[model samples]
Target: MANIIILGAGIGGMSAAYEIRDAIGKEHAITVVGDGPVFNFTPSNPWLAVGWRKPDEIRLNVTEPLESRNIRFVPTRANKVVAEANRLDLVDGSSLNYDYLVITTGPRLAFERVPGSGPEGFTQSVCTGPHAEKAWLSYEEFLKKPGPVVVGALQGASCFGPAYEFAMILDTDLRRRKLRDRVPMTFVTSEPYIGHMGLGGIGDSKGLLESEMRQRHIKWISNARVTSVEQGKINAEQLDEQSAVLKTHELPFSYSMFIPPFAGVDAVQGIEGLTNPGGFILIDEHQCNPTFPNIFAAGVCVAIPPVEVTPVPTGAPKTGLMIESMVTAIANNLRDVLAGKPMKARATWNAMCLADMGDSGFAFIALPQIPPRNVTKAMSGKWVHLAKVAYEKYFLRKMRKGKADPIYETYVMKAFGIDRLKLEENID
Candidate 1:
């Protein structure tokens, strides 16, 4: 029987396990290794931080489902991976060998890159459950005594959605509490433009996002590198091409949330022939490591170069749908390999994003993550917010039941509302 070892139990890994479980069945052995027992729903982190979701509401114990599927569950952090030996060593002093390995450990937030960027005592983040808890308490304190607030992403940070979401959510919350006028809000980012979003403005997103921020009365500074952060001030550098002009700005704030730059998990770092300089796993379009054919990777852990280094340095953001596509491609390829058939065409992942804007949301679709394809025109409306809510509910139900279906994929594609998407040729 073939033995499969999957690393990390996050969204991409869990979805791949579920898909592979049905495809390979008892004929093959599957094992899942995770650093912890709880599976965090990252998208809901912001809501939890804002007092909309509780810790228990977003946490799911993954042991039961894997047990039912007869998949081995090892609740231990992976410390080292010997790609040549096809083995993984765990932090708990155990090791396992595998016929095939899948890595989906997700991104590592480089908190130490920026001074005082952590939650040791100052600032807060909604990137994880513990961080969200701290953020909730910090936000409560801020509510009690409103003051200046700064929210944005750090240098080389690719995940822009959460930063934008948190800013809007905070604005909505402050306005609801009649404290919007009192809070001196500033939106800061490393992007060159207000709506760059790391993907160079999907479609009309530039105009729409800029207009929205203007309406919200949030001050912004682009192409700004955060040098250091103090209790009530920020040290930044106004960067032009190949040079920087140092500038320090003091703005006392009761609360601040800054998205840190993302890198590959330490386990994947320094591994020979596996990752890029940034430590993200390097995979072909099929999600298979070109250096190690038996290894595959997905999610934020994989290296996808920036669409353009442009006006400001920014990396591409891999959303849920994009990760799902990568996982699907890897699963299908594995199935083909087991069946002794040539692998199918490499996956051409497209990005579909819906950014919720409180009362309404903006939706955008990029046919192929890399340009020169049929990138759809971005659309927005109140209905988009309703759809996003429905999607969250649908996703939670599916995960709770340990089910994987194509319905979610089709639904996401339909949400793009582009006619060309109906054609199969447009996908590959």
Candidate 2:
């Protein structure tokens, strides 16, 4: 029997554990290693930051559910990944060996890339549960003395959805509190345009997002690289299409939140042939590492190049639907390999997002995620916001029960008339 170890118990990790268990059954042992026992619904972080959702509402004790599924749970951080030896060294000094390993550790918030940014610095973050909670606290303090607000993603940042979501949510909250008049909001982003979103804008995303911002009275600065952030001030260089600095702006704000760049966690960095320079795991179409076939990766930890070059550096996003496809593909491939069959399953790499803007929201889907896609759709309305709320609850419930349901495949794909996984023989 093979000992399969899955690292990181967030969305991708938890789903992988359940899917692999269902795929392989009782023939093998499955273990999940995570730094903590709780799993935070990361997509809901923007809502949590704005007081629309509580911490408990988005956090779940994953130990019980995973254990109930007959999966071993190790609540400890990994010190290092000894890939050559097929072993992992835990922070507690214990070592665990595995026949196969799946990495879903997600990205490490590279806040240090920008000085005087992140929670420890002058700016706030909604990347994690604790970070969002901190952002809420800081936001409450700022509410007492409302001033200018700044929100956007920094250079080399990958996930741009949350940055947009939080900005709009903050606007909705302030308007509800009758404090919108007192606060001047500005969006500073590395994207060349307002809705490039790293995938070069899906459907009418640019026009839709731009229209929304205009209607809400939120000003924006595109192709911006934050040079430094001070206590109440942020310095940025606006770049032209040729990557030349066109102007430098010294903006002042009482509240600020910027999505910092992401890198692979420390545990998996600097291993030859294991990860890219940015520390993200290097996987082929099958989601298996090129150098070590026994190793696989999914979620934000997987390396994907930017869709297109921008004036300022930007990384592609790995949306929930995209990660789900990755997890499913990995599980199916593992099952095939364990059965003495060649690995054939491949993730669709599709992208879908329900970006809540408090009162309203925007939804988009990009087939195959990369440019020159077969399909792309985008829309905005209040129903999208409601759908996001429902989706959060559904996802949390799925995690709590350890169900191996292909949610995106069943619901989302059916709605859009698409498929989730493609086999090697089927790919042209």
Candidate 3:
């Protein structure tokens, strides 16, 4: 029987465990190691930060369901991976030997990359459920007395969607409270344009996002490198890449929420022939590390090159659909290996993103998740917001009931109108 150890229990990790176990059957043993037992739906963090959802409503314990599957659950941090030995050492001094290891530990939040980005007691983040809870409390108190607010992504940061969602959510909330005029909102980012969004503005997103910001009376600053942040101001550098000049500016704010640059989990970082310079796991288009054939990576921890370079670089965010495709690829590869059959790697897919703007939301789909695509579209509607809420409820229910259906694949193909492409890409 194959002994597989999966790291992290987030969306990608959990999905990996489910897919692998179903394909390989009960003879194979699967164990999942994660930092915590709670699976936090990170996409809803922005709503949590804005006090739209309670803390308990956002978290679901993963132990009981995983236990029902006879999958061992190790609630501890993965300290290191001994790739040569095919083993993992835990932070609690425990260890495990494995025949195959799937490193799904998602991206690490590199808050320290920027000075004063986070010390827990000072600056706040809505990246995680617990972090969002803290930010929600702070927001409630901050709203009692108005002040300037700052929100944006930092240099080398890839996840810019949440920053935009949170900014708009807060703006809509403040407007409802009649404090929009009292609070000065400034969006400070490292991207070159308003709607760059790491994919070079799908279709006319640049015009659409900028126009929306103007309509909402939201101010923005781009091509900014936030050198450091103080109690009331952020020191940034404006660069003219062609001229190579750096101009400094000080922007004041009463509250700030900045998305940190991401790096690979410590367990896989710096391992020979395993990780990139930025500490993200190095995987080919097939989602497998070429040097370690038995190892695979998915989600934010994997390295993907930026589509384009602006004044400051912008990298694409790997959305849920893309991650699902990666998971399918990895599972199929492993299945073939165990069955003594040839492996097939699937092609990289595009992305569909739904960003909630409080009472309403925006829907976007890009063929290549970059410019010059066959199809790039974005639309704003209240249904998008309602759909997101319904999705979260349905996903959590499925997890609680211990049914990991491949229904998400159908949902994705339907949204993109590419269901037939799956058959075209099949290599049976």
Candidate 4:
């Protein structure tokens, strides 16, 4: 019997655990190591910040559901990982040994990159549920006396969707309360353009987003590198394609949300041969570490190259669909390895994103998220907003049931011509 250890019980790790449980059954022991007991529906954090979702609504006690599946659950921070010994040091004064390990611990928000950024700093964040709740409190206070608002991403930052979503949602919320006219909003982003979105302008996204921002009366500054943040103010430099500063501005804000750059968590960072310079796990096409064959990774912890170079450094955001596909690849390959069979499965790495714009939304599809792909699409409508809401409910329901990918989700993907795996037969 093989003992499989999966680290980080967030979206990717939980999805991997469910798939592994379904594939390998009860014969093998499955253990999940997580930093905490609750799993937050991260994509809904923007809603949480605007008082649309309560803390309980977006969180699930992870232990109850996983224990029901006959899986071992250890809720503690991982202190260190000894890859060579196949041992994981935990915060609870114990270590777990495993034949195979999967790391899905998400990024460590690099708020320190800018001197006065993040929730603890002058600016606000909606990256996590607690942060979102805090942001909502701040939002409430802001509503009392509306003024200037700034929202955007920092250099070397991925996950631009949430930043964009939060901005629009906040705008909608303020308007609903008849406070839009009292607030002056500005979008300052590391991306070279309004709709670059770290994927180099997905299907005229530049034009579409620019138009939408204009319609919403949200002014923007792109290729902006934020040097520091202060109380009700931000200092930033706008750079050109040549990497020369074209302008510097001191923008004032009553509230702000900046997506900081992400790096591998401290537990696994700086491990020679295990991670890249940025501390993200380096994996082959199969999601297995080339140097540590028994090690695999999924989600934001995995390193993916920037889609294209920008004047201001930007990293591509890995959409949830793509992360789930990575889970499939890693699960299949791990199953093969433990069964003494040749491992051969690759992730589709497709990007299927639904960006909620409060009452309206936008959806984008880029097969093989790295660009130069076979499929590329971007659309917007009220249906997209409704679809996003439905997905949140369906996804949480699936997580509660210890199910991986549901059948209806498959049909939805099929309608979009998306498949999770890149099998040998399916590949050209």
At residue 271, what lDDT does model 3 achieve? 89
Give the runs in model 3 whose Cα sits over 4 Å from its true position. Answer: 119-121, 241-243, 406-428
Instruction: Judge candidate 4 at residue 238 and give its lDDT.
Output: 99
Per-residue lDDT value at 150 in model 3: 87
Query: What would the per-residue lDDT of candidate 2 be over residues 87-170, giving only the tens digit for each residue?
Result: 999999999999999999999999899999999999999999999999999998999999999999999999999999999999
Residue-by-residue lDDT tens digits, candidate 1, 1-428 = 88999898988888888888876667888999998888887777877888878888777888887777778888899998889999999998889999999999988888888887868735678788889989998898888888888898888899888888888878877788888999988888998787778887777777888888898998887788887888877767767666456455555567899888899898888987899988999998688898999999988898998988754568899887788778778888888888898777465577767767776777777777677667555777887767776666666677777664543363464455444346334643
Worst 10-residue lDDT window for candidate 4 reads 419-428
Residues 1-428, candidate 3, lDDT per residue (tens digit)?
Answer: 89999888988888888888887888889999999899898888998998888877878889998988888899899999988889999999989999888888888888888888863534678788888988888898898888999899988889888988999999999999999999988898888888778887776777878887888888988888888988888888877765254688788888888888887777887888988888888887778888887788888888888888677766678887677778878888888888998778663556668788888877777776666666667777787787778777877787787756553453344433446464234311
Cα RMSD (angstroms) for every candidate in the order listed: 2.2, 2.3, 2.6, 2.2
Predicted structure 3: clash tally: 0
* Candidate 3 Cα lDDT to native: 0.81
TM-score of each: 0.94, 0.96, 0.94, 0.96
- In order, candidate lDDTs are 0.80, 0.90, 0.81, 0.86
lDDT of residue 245 for candidate 2: 94
- 1 versus 4: better TM-score goes to: 4
- By lDDT: ranked, best first: 2, 4, 3, 1
Clash pairs, model 1 backbone: none
Off by over 4 Å in 1: 241-243, 246-248, 406-424
User: Over the stretch 1-428, how does candidate 4's per-residue lDDT look in tens digits?
Assistant: 98899999988888888888887778999999998899998989999998999988988888878988988899999999899999999988899999999999999999998999999998889887888999999988888888999999999899888888988998898889888999899999999998888887778778888888999999999999999999989999999999999999999999999899999999888789999999999999899999998999988999999988899999988887778878988889988887889889888776767889998987777665776766677888887788888778878887787665732253245433444344212331
